[model samples]
Target: MAEKKEQPDASKDEPEQIVDPWRVVTTSEKGVDYDKLIRQFGSERIDDAMLKRFEEVTGHKPHRFLRRGIFFSHRELKNILDLYEAKKPFFLYTGRGPSSSSMHVGHLIPFIFTKWLQDVFDVPLVVQMTDDEKFLWRELETPDVARNLAYENAKDIISCGFHRDKTFIFSNIDYISSCAAFYKNMLKVEKLVTFNQVRGIFGFNESDAIGKISFPAIQATPSFSNSFPEIFGEAADVPCLIPCAIDQDPYFRMTRDVAPKLNYLKPALIHSTFFPALQGAQTKMSASDKTSSIFLTDTQEEIKNKINRYAYSGGGSTEAEHREKGGDCDVDISYQYLTFFLEDDDRLAKIKEEYSSGRMMTGELKRELVVVLQSLIGDIQEKRRAVTDDIRRHFMTPRKLNHKA
Candidate 1:
C-alpha cells in the first residue's frame, strides 16, 4: 500500500520544506540522472561514481542509501571523515525545532545516524532541542510550546539508543541560561554575523526578532565544546562535527566563518538530503498533515493503513502495465524508505531487483517497508517508555565533563 504521487512542491505551506533545493543536481543522457539531483538540490550534485571515489577515499563503504541517491547531496563530508581518521575527536551536534507533539518516524533520521557516529567514534554528543526556534517562526506560544515540546522531543530522541553517560540533550530555553561559555560563544557569533549575512544565507527578514535574527547563534553554540564547559571540562579548543540534514547547513557555515576569530576549531559536517514526505521527494513531510508521515505512536494497524493509503508508488496503474513497463525505483516510496531502514544489504538487493523489474507488486513492496519500519519503531517505543522526566532533567543538567586526559 502506497499513496499516489502529488505535485513536487506539495508541502509549500509547511515551515521547513518551503524552499526548493538549496542547491542543484546534474544529469547526463548516457548514465546516471545528474540533472534531477542538480535541479532538486542546486548546481552541486554528488553522483554515483563520485560516491565510489569517496568510499575509496575514506576506506568505508558509502552508507547504502547514500549509494542509492536517497541521500544525494553533501558538503565537506570527506574532510570530516578524514579528521576522524587522523584521531581528531569532533563531538556531534544536531537539533530539532520542535513544532509538534509526538514526532513522526521520519524525524529520527539524523538522531539514528548520529548515534552510529557517536558509537563509532566514542565521542560526547550534544543534541539541541530548538523549541525557541519553533516559537520564533511559527505562531506557537514561546513558553508553553518550547517547554512542552522539549519534554516530548527528549522522549523521542532518547528512544534512539543514545548512551546515557555520553549523551547531553538541551533545549535552548534551559541551556542558554546556565552556560556562560555558551553565551560568550553566542556573542562572538553575533558580533561576526550581520543582519545582511543572515538575510543572504537564510532569507530572513528585517521584521524578524533580534531573538529570531540572533537565533542562529544559539544553534551554533553547541558546535563549540565550551558551550558545555561543565561537560567538556571547559575545553574551548575542542571542535565538534555535526551530522545534519543538508537544509541545516547554512547555520554551521556561519559558525565556521566565525570560529577563526573566536580561536575555536571550525566544526566539520556531514549533511543529508531531506527525507521526502510520504507523498513525494519534492517537499518535506509535515507533522501537521496526518497522511504526509507515519508517527512513532502509530499502532501496527495505523502503520499498515497509512502505508496503504498514503505512501506514494511508482508502480503503473494496471498490473499488466506495471509488469510490462517495470517499476521506477527512482521515486518508488517503498524502495526509498527501505534504503533508510534496511541494514541488510542482500535482502535490500533482492527487494530492489524484484521491485524495479516489477516482479513484486507495489503492495508487496510496501508491506516489506511497513514490516521493517514497524520493527524499528516498536523497538524505539519500548526504550522511550523507560525515559522519565527525572532522567530528562538529569541529562539536561550541565555536569562536569568526564575527561580522559
Candidate 2:
C-alpha cells in the first residue's frame, strides 16, 4: 500500500493576533475587527435613521465621511443636533497631540471633517495642540521639542482652510500660564479622577511618571467652556462637540463621567475610524515610520513609490488568478484610501464594481489613488506655503471669535 500523505498543520496558517483597539496599534498584518471594537468600546453606531436626522437638522447633506460610515461612532451626537435645532450655542473642540514636526495624510481626516462641521454649524472652533501631553507621552528630550512641533503642526492644521476669525488654536504649554480657569478646571477634573481610574482607563503602570497619570486631566479641562474664557466668556455654559478618532474616546469618557459632578455639559463626540497604514488596517499609520504613511511633505515620486511598494493588495497571486478571483476592496489599501479622498461617489462606486469584478487591475486602482492623493496633498502644500508667521499667529491668537450663526 502507498504511504499516507502527511497532513499539514492548520494552526500555522491562522492569521496574526489582532492589535488592541485601545492602544495606537501600529500596522498589524491582519486587520482589526471594527464590530468587536464598537461593542467593546460601548459606542453607538451611526445608522440610517441617525443619518437622516443629521441631514434634516443640519439643513445640508451629511458629509461623505458621515454617509460612508467613516465617522462611525458617537456619544450624545443627537444631543448636539438637538441643541443646534433649538438654536442653542455650542462650540467645536478637536485636538492634535503634536509629537512630530510634520503631519501625514492620515492627520488631515479629522481637521477636514471638523472644517466641514464648522462651516455647516457656523460655530467657533477651538483646536488644542497637546504639546504638554506629547512631551509626557512621547520620548522627547525637552518641552521645546513638543512646543516647536506644536507650531509646525498648527501650520498644517491652518492649511486646511479653517476660518481664522472663528478658529482658535492653542498649545497647552503656552496657554496654561495665560488662563487661570483652565488650571482650575484641570484641578477639578484631577480631583474627581482616581489613580486607579486612570490606570484602568489608560493601562498606566506604577513605573509611569506622575505627569503621565495627570495628563488626562489637562486634556479633559478643554471640554469645559470655562477653560477658554477668551472665546466663550467667563463662566459660559457653552457645550462642546469633539471630533476625534475612536481611540480617544477613553479620554472623553473619563471627561464625561466627571462632567456631571462639575455641573458642566458633557461634551458631545463624533469618532472616526483609524486611517489604515499603507500595508493594511490592522495598524494605525505611524508618523515616525516612513514606510507606513504618506506625509504632507512627501514628494510626488515618494507617494507613487510607496503606494506601489508597500500598499497591501487584495488581488490574487497571478494575473489570470486575479481575473478569476477578483480583488477584495475591503482589504485593499489603495481602494480604501480612494474611499476617503475621492469625493465623487458615483465614480468611486463604478471603480469599486470594476475592481471587484476583476475588470480593473490593482495597478490601475493604485494609479487612481496616487492621482487623487497627489492633487490633494499638492493643494495643501501650496496653501501651507502661504501660511506665514503672521498668518500662523492670527490662527493661534486667543482673541474673541466672530461666532455669529
What is the lDDT of every predicted structure here? Answer: 0.74, 0.87
Off by over 4 Å in 2: 1-22, 26-30
- Give a tens-digit lDDT track for model 1, residues 1-405: 111112323343422323421322222111223334244333245576667766665566766656666555654556666666676656778878787878987788888878876766677788898888887777885577766888798889988988788888888887787777888888888988899988866777877787878888888888888788777767787767787766676677677778877888778666665666787665677878989888988888888898888888889899998898878777877777888899988998998898788888999999998899889888888888898989888777777534333
lDDT of 2 by residue, 269-357 (tens): 89998899998887788888999989999999999999999999988778998899898998999999998999999999999999998
TM-score per model over all chains: 0.85, 0.93
Q: Cα deviation in Å at residue 145, candidate 2?
A: 1.2
Candidate 2 lDDT score relative to the true structure: 0.87
Task: Output the worst ten-in-a-row residue range by lDDT, candidate 2.
Answer: 1-10
Superposed on all Cα atoms, model 2 deviates from the true structure by an RMSD in Å of 7.9
Candidates in order: C-alpha RMSD to true structure: 7.0, 7.9
Best by lDDT: 2
